[model samples]
Each structure stands twice: as C-alpha cells, then as structure tokens.
Target: MERVTGVGGVFFKSKEPAALAAWYRDHLGLELEPGSEAVSVFRWSEPGTTTWSAFPEDTQYLGRAESRAMFNYRVKNLDRMLAQLRADAVFVDDRVEISKFGRFGWAIDPEGNRFELWEPADGL
Candidate 1:
C-alpha cells in the first residue's frame, strides 16, 4: 500500500488570523473567500489538488502543545496505512474520525510533530 500519495493541506497558527490572511491576499495574491470568523477556503484548480490554510496561534487543533504547524498528508487507505505504521512501531493516535468529508487519523513523528492523515471522500 502507498504510504502517502501527496499533501492534503498545510495548517499553521497566527495571532491575528484576519490580518495575516489579508497580508497573504495583498502580498501573496491569494484569492481568499470570506467565511465565518477569519476562515478562508482556497479550492484546488485540479480535481485532487492540495489545500493550504493557517490557523489561530491559540488553536489546539494541531495538538495540546505549542506546535507551530501541522501537515495533512493524503493517504490511499487511512486504516491500512495507520495499521502499517503501528506495525512498524510508529506511535499512531487511537482516534479515528469519519465524516462526510472523509476519514482522518494522526501520527507523531520522531521529532514529536503531530501530523494528520486524510483519506478523502469519494469524488472529492
């Protein structure tokens, strides 16, 4: 089984999400969409392209620690991939979540960076 197909998304934290997003838009020319709070969704030009976004500095979504960022890796089979990681003595998180979007899992790297694995929903 393929371990990681590609990058799904890149997430990081910011003290002022709105100001930071505006900076990206103005300086980087990212066409940001308006959403609740300071969230922005940058759709992929290709069907299965990747996503990139920045989170709030105080957000604990990455982990309970002060992780600067988290990378979401696209996986072929999330369950199987996680199983393989565990079999190889990797510290895979026990929590597996499924939603309309797709399945999600987490694993810690040797450096202790908490990263996410995503198996996208069909037709996504």
Candidate 2:
C-alpha cells in the first residue's frame, strides 16, 4: 500500500476572498488563489509535539463550525512572525502561553477561523 505523503493544500471558503487572499499573501507570504476553490500552499515541517490532540465535537470555535481545523504550522522564529502580524493590524488574540511542550499563540483569519502558531520546545 502506498502511504500518503503530506498535505498538498488547504481549501476553504472566505467571505472577503480578495481581502483575505491579500492578507495571507502580505502577512504569511502564502500565495492564495482568490476564488471559491482558493488554496494557500506552504512548505510545512514535522510537528514539534508528538501527541496531537483534538477538540470535542460540541466545541463552539469558529474553525470547528467550518468542517475541521486542518493544519497547524510550526515556526522556529515565532516572535518575529507575530511581530509581522501585529504590524499588519491583524486580529491576533494576545493569549500566548508557554507550556512544558512549547510556545502557543492564536491568529484569526478574515473568515473568523482561529489558526494556531506554535514554537516547539527545544531538544524534542
């Protein structure tokens, strides 16, 4: 059996498609194709955390309502990325927390989906 390699792209619906595409392009440097079948592709790495967790079915989160929250990209320079997002006036929830695992922060897209930005603990 041929095993699946990795995620190719992430497709989602955006209310303000153009604006959102521009936001992703300007901030995250993701080249978003503006349309209903828009996808933002990026070169991702292995997750820092070994054990991946999932939210309950009855969750009240924005992303939860829209099918499933697909990807959580890991970053080595999270602070710098966060700074860039801040400069763009993007809506970032300032509830950053450092746990035994790694550092975590949240950023909501124009469509109100909460995406996680993680910086994993060293020597994992």
Candidate 3:
C-alpha cells in the first residue's frame, strides 16, 4: 500500500501576519511573501525525511503552560539559523539542548504561540 511521503504544508493562526511574514523572510529567509497563500510548504533537501514529536500543555516543551504547539524544520546549519534569528531580534529560547539528537530552538509567534526549530545531526 502507498503511504504518506512528507509534509505538504503548515497552517497556523497569526495576528500580525504582515509583520510575522516579514520576520520570517528577513530572519529565516523563508519564502513567505506578503499577500501570498496562508499555507507554507518547506521542501526537504534529502529524501525519506520524516519525524514524529509531541508536546504537552503545561510546562511541556516551550514556555507555554496552557497550550502546546511544536514544529520542526530540517535546517542545514543550526548555529547559523540561530544566529540569523538572533540577528533579526527574534525571541529565541535556548533553554533546551540535546547531545545526540539535534539542537533545539524556539520562538514565539506574533500571536504568542510557541514554535520549535530542529537541526538534526548528520545522517540522522
């Protein structure tokens, strides 16, 4: 039987969409142009890339204790990505770290929601 290959898009609610979209473009260099579609699709560089994750509602992963939301991005450079976000003045939470899995980073959206960024280890 045929199975799911990868994620098609990410849909999330935002309040200051214009600023948020611009932040994504300037900070992370994402392809989220202003006046574009609501859904954003990120293509994987390598094949057969799939991941599973879970978060809790209270003190789960991020600072949000009432709501839980997380997402991962396959980035080429973790340090560089973090640097970019920092340079853009994005609020990055660096309280979490791992040895073998990958680097974990986060930033709250304009609507006060938590989002995760993952830069997996080589050959992960």
lDDT of every predicted structure (CA atoms) = 0.82, 0.56, 0.53
TM-score of structure candidate 1 = 0.88
User: How many pairs collide in each candidate, listed in order?
Assistant: 0, 0, 0
Which candidate has the highest lDDT of all? Answer: 1
4-123 in candidate 3: lDDT tens per residue?
223322333344545566676678766642446332334358642443322222335545555544555556566676678778788877765765756666677677777666666665
Q: For model 1, where is the 10-residue window of minimal lDDT?
A: 34-43
Which portions of model 1 show Cα errors greater than 4 Å?
34-46
In model 2, pairs of residues that clash are: none
Looking at model 3, how many pairs of residues clash?
Answer: 0
Which model, 1 or 3, shows the larger TM-score?
A: 1
lDDT (tens digit, per residue) of candidate 1 on 33-65: 656444455566665656657788889889856
Best by TM-score: 1
Q: Can you write out model 2's per-residue Cα lDDT over 82-103, one digit (the tens) per residue?
A: 7778888888777787997577
lDDT score for candidate 1 against the true structure: 0.82
Candidate number with the higher TM-score (1 or 2): 1
